[model samples]
Target: MKNILRTAGVLAVASASVLTGVTAAQAAPSCSTARVCLYDDYWFTGTPRSFGWVTYNVGVDSNDKGSSLVIGPATDPASPYVYFYVDNNFAGNNVVFRAGNASNDLRGLYMTPTRNWDDEITSVWG
Candidate 1:
């Protein structure tokens, strides 16, 4: 009886642990922490590109091509955020996103007072 009880307790703990791990995995973004991930399509679908802490021009694989994005916590959590620019070299109109934020699409994001961000991102600061 003792052996059976101990085994049941162990199995219960193991099952709980496994379920917790699955929930965490499902909640996590596809990209790593401290990086910004850009998606080619809405709802984080399509090709993905990740950027670390730096200001860079979006090039071949992702230039003026981002339709959605996920911003993860920065290396320093307190300063977690990224900026998307309308023109290269981080110039022109821009929009900001804080850590852990994801946009399904850019079609409704304001790049400037006069422009939308969808498919017009030329640079980024992460």
Candidate 2:
């Protein structure tokens, strides 16, 4: 009887853990509805250069706000490398960049309002 009780307890704990994981996963935001804009070979002029604008509706929930910018490789022929930005903030360098190869040229953008921004950013980058 004691062995059966122990096994039942273990099963209950395992089930609880699995359910918790599934619930957390379900709560996570998805980028399926994310709006993406792409541009090619553009030059920078000044601070806050407009890459593009995103205007969401009342019902749409955005995980973050930013655009992905691509720049040509230094020597490789891979067309361009990807950079990210969030709220106009650069992801990799933590410094803003221009459209081309400016000092702060942003390869991409990603901005999240939640306290879990760091985790979300890390996940996105990875």
Candidate 3:
């Protein structure tokens, strides 16, 4: 009985550790080089949206639906940052996201009364 209990305890600890690790990994964001990724929810959770090289007026689908984003290292040396706007047609409050800098959560960067930009982005460019 004593040996059996010890084995069960070890298995329980191992399982807990594995679960914890998975949760931590899911809470972080991973960005690919030369691309921009936006997460619908903070801490890199929820829907993942990607963008490429272009001057864009974020379409209706992704409009006002970004909570956090990742700006990968600029593959083009001349363009080292991405500019985002709070309104359509690149109008309203704007923010710059430099290459090699990003966040898992937007609450620190973009915020509202509730969740950071829960659904309030309109345009982007790099």
Report the Cα lDDT for residue 45, model 2. Answer: 20
In order, the Cα lDDT scores of the candidates are 0.76, 0.29, 0.72
Clashes of 3: 1
**Quick one: ranking by TM-score, best first?**
1, 3, 2
Which scores higher on lDDT, 1 or 2?
1
TM agreement with the true structure for every prediction? 0.70, 0.20, 0.66
Query: Which should have the higher TM-score, number 1 or number 3?
Result: 1
Indicate whether candidate 2 or candidate 3 has the larger lDDT.
3
Clashes of 2: 13
Lowest lDDT block of 10, candidate 1: 21-30
What would the per-residue lDDT of candidate 2 be over residues 2-74, giving only the tens digit for each residue?
9999999888877876987543322312111221222222222221212221222111122232222222222
Where does model 3 exceed 4 Å of error?
1-28, 53-55, 110-118
Candidate 2, overall lDDT? Answer: 0.29
Best candidate according to TM-score: 1
The parts of candidate 2 lying over 4 Å away from their true place are 22-126
- Worst 10 contiguous positions by lDDT, candidate 2: 117-126
Q: Write the per-residue lDDT of candidate 3 for residues 22-53, one digit (tens) a residue.
A: 44455446577777788888767678888763
